[model samples]
Target: MSTSGGRPRRSRSTAVRRRPADRRQQILDAAARAFSEGGYHAVRLDQIADDAGISAAALYRHFPNKYALFCETTSGLAERLAVAIAGVESDQPDPRTELSELLATIATTAIDNRRTGGLYRWESQYLDRSDAEPVRSVVITQHRRMRTQLIRIRPELSRADADLITSAMTSVVASPATHRASLPIRDAQTLLRDVAAGLVDVELPVPRLEPPAPAGLAPSAKREIILAESISLFAARGFHDVTIEEIGAASGVPASGVYRHFSGKAAILEAAFWRASDRTTACITDALAVSSTPREAIVELVRRYVEVWCGNRDLIMVYASEIGHLEPDRRTALRRQQRINVEEWTTWVVRSRPELGAARARYLVHAALAAISDLVRLDRSSEPARIGPLAQRILLGA
Candidate 1:
């Protein structure tokens, strides 16, 4: 390069040159972090490019579009998790040692990737079925491996029991990725490993073998239909992707009729949040009223929570994932209600285990709740009968 004076000047290196493969990986890392922080719809490709220290054109050369990038980022993380599990040394003769080592490895990997590990949890739903299948397959394969080790350790556990326990352990390890709860790295790993290992020996409550009675017909009221359909649509496609017309069509009501029932999509979501909060509060009241001791109250609360969550999976799923799209005032109110719910759990947990300070108790409670919620989302066959007891054990840290 020549200077403006026409004399050849020393060429200045402004930017480091990177190989295409290296730059593509850099983009993936940045995209993972961006998607993890802001979710699928909220993050922009330009922001990811900037974070990767590349231009928008350069990013396009690597990834054709945002959705493609998102799919790769999510599936890539799942593949990484599978590979991490595959790398765990499993030659130990004692299955117990093998299981412990596996859990520890999982905890370490989850903690190490905590910043981006949560992408597959809530955001991967945005992927098309074809793109999502690879991620799902990877996760299932890892779960099967864990379940194998679990079955080896406990030869008598039914396959269903082992699957549930294995799911709970993976959820426990992955729980740290969902929240900002902090501990020293070593302490965090130990805490996760211990909680996961505890689930191996947990005696799951016997599942009900009887078939449930046939469901009754849907509600005839237009307002009831709108709310129910809206929750289902929101849970399945996300709030932003669902339109007022779609909700009306799903409910068999005209758009004009839907307006008479609720103000808009946001209003329906607000109503869903309120509905969940009211039901949860009622459960807490009922639990405390029926229990004479803190431990009893805790167990009752866990059972009630599992019941509520199971009965209203669509509503609860919307409640968990769509909260960010609500208006600030309503979001603030709902978040306050959520904290109150957590405080209720924390109080009972500390009362039952006095040695666990409020902070530690709260952390454990979050992990337990995350485990149940994640399991519910991931496992369609999850039964309240099995979940209630497993959740109770996790909450009590037994």
Candidate 2:
């Protein structure tokens, strides 16, 4: 088929040709946004290519596979953060000023990369150890830098305390990535900086020594065993990746036995969620009952939350990451329960600080919770007592 003039009409292609370096950057930017929004397995190469305004073949020309692209995207993000604070000097005359400036830089970087910064939090689990290590190393280095400055400001802080506070502070600055809460850029930065700075003065509780495990273990019911195994598996590998058979095997039961104990994997997940919700509700009740004032209740609530998170890190991980895989009705119910819990905290927060309107109180509540949850998620050795005080500082603005 020819045009009316009997000559083939040349179609004008809308694609813009990019230099090699520019095209690579474009692909990485698109992939980072994609992976941050959708988890690793859910994102497709062709989709990223489309986002980058390139053909699939063109995408392949730069990166061999999606894994490579993902590694590059995440590593690039970590490197960007490292660069943001590279010039920060701990030798500055005023340690508080130095830390403040450092936090300001971090706040600005977090806001700038808010769209894609979440990949390191949620999707890094899918990365291989070799691919993940460099990214982790970069983050650890940044944390060390912040810790150094924090120690400089507070000379009395022990190495462990400095590390814990630094982790909490960084988590607060990075909290924007994990949620969709929006604020003006300047307001967001100031909020993060102020909250993080508050953590500097937080007095960590003395680290408690744990007693050794008992020599003998009491036998648990098969249902409890299955539930426990499923939570660990789901936390270690996401819900979608684990199978009923695998859960059964881990629990030393057959797949048929697992069905007898629970309906399926989703049922197990739902049970885990209910277990978490019930515990949280119990803590809230206990906190309110024992406290004489709203401030005391909030502090007690933070203590309880930190204890629960530290003891049940895997369970908290499952609760945070696997909510999307639950049945719609169950998911909605659990989410509603979460909102109720947050509302309780927000109420106490507003009562404790009437100057802070309900909206700002809720904002602080989320920031404090995110700071605690993320620190627990990232550090297995995080002590509850230490984290509890930092969380209190954030919430109480102490």
Candidate 3:
């Protein structure tokens, strides 16, 4: 009864299922886990069925094939995005805060809710017209809604410029460069806040959001191994430089068996990237719950962020140096994602520091990113403590 894959790769020989409702949810849940872990291409119905404790034949009875399942998976994510943003109506209040709440939700949803967001992030490969128009239309509409919001917030700007800024900011959120390799470290919120500051031109501070770790909540040893190996592969080679073959060998999984966990290279890359973004965002949100003042919040936020940025420089190198190597369509989609991450950061920059105009804030945020991203890709690790002090100087004037 389980469906697998973003678009489940189906076997023609499987028998069709009979019960519609129960069967569909079973398939969808399995599909969700599978798609979230890998992506559409890696999903296989046999695997889904096994996860669901059903025969492959039973799965096909409800859904026609893999493509059918993919359509179902990605169907409403973008529409919800549009709807969520559209609900943030407020001309009387500070436009910057309004945008932050709206965008923060997007970062959380896109970065955390793996199935829906994963489809939003990675399903472009299957977006042929023959596939379906609903998901595509929803995403477009959501983007358009965001554009309108940008225009209102920056009333001094031209429509084209507003659109451009909107486009650029959204791309930042989705970018792999902003994604942390495997944990909700500090960089997620920092990168998001940076992008927003870059787009809107602001001097607001980054806020911390993570809470203290509870018992039994730390990452497992297995997760660490995956991250350490991926960092090497992504750093030395580009995204495509190391294959699942290399990753499997480095991580100690059987090459053929890697598909059991991750179906393809891109999906694996996406997962690794997701680990970075999700953990970062979680950290920020958690910190926000406890920090008493904006300055303290910003300090902790930046401290965690600098540590993460320095520690994972190799992964950042792999992500940045190799992203252009992705197929053209993926490149475009990821560009949009990258924008979102930046805009999230930019929002905080604007909110916390009202001194600079939008233009100046935008410049500073992007400039800061430019200054720091270089350090991220550097392979030399001799000077261990440089990033923290430097980041404090940038944000805290300490």
Best by lDDT: 2
Which is the leading candidate under TM-score? 1
Ranking by lDDT: 2, 1, 3
Model 2 alpha-carbon miss at residue 45, Å: 4.8
Q: All models: lDDT?
A: 0.82, 0.83, 0.56
Per-residue CA lDDT of model 2 for 176-240, tens digit only, reads 77666667789888888888998988887777788624535634999988998899899998988
Q: In angstroms, give how far residue 48 of model 3 lies from its true place.
A: 2.2
TM per prediction: 0.85, 0.83, 0.43
Question: What would you estimate as the lDDT of candidate 3?
Answer: 0.56
Model 1 scores worst on lDDT over the 10 consecutive residues at 10-19
TM-score of 1: 0.85
How does model 3 score by TM-score? 0.43
In candidate 2, position 142 carries an lDDT of: 80
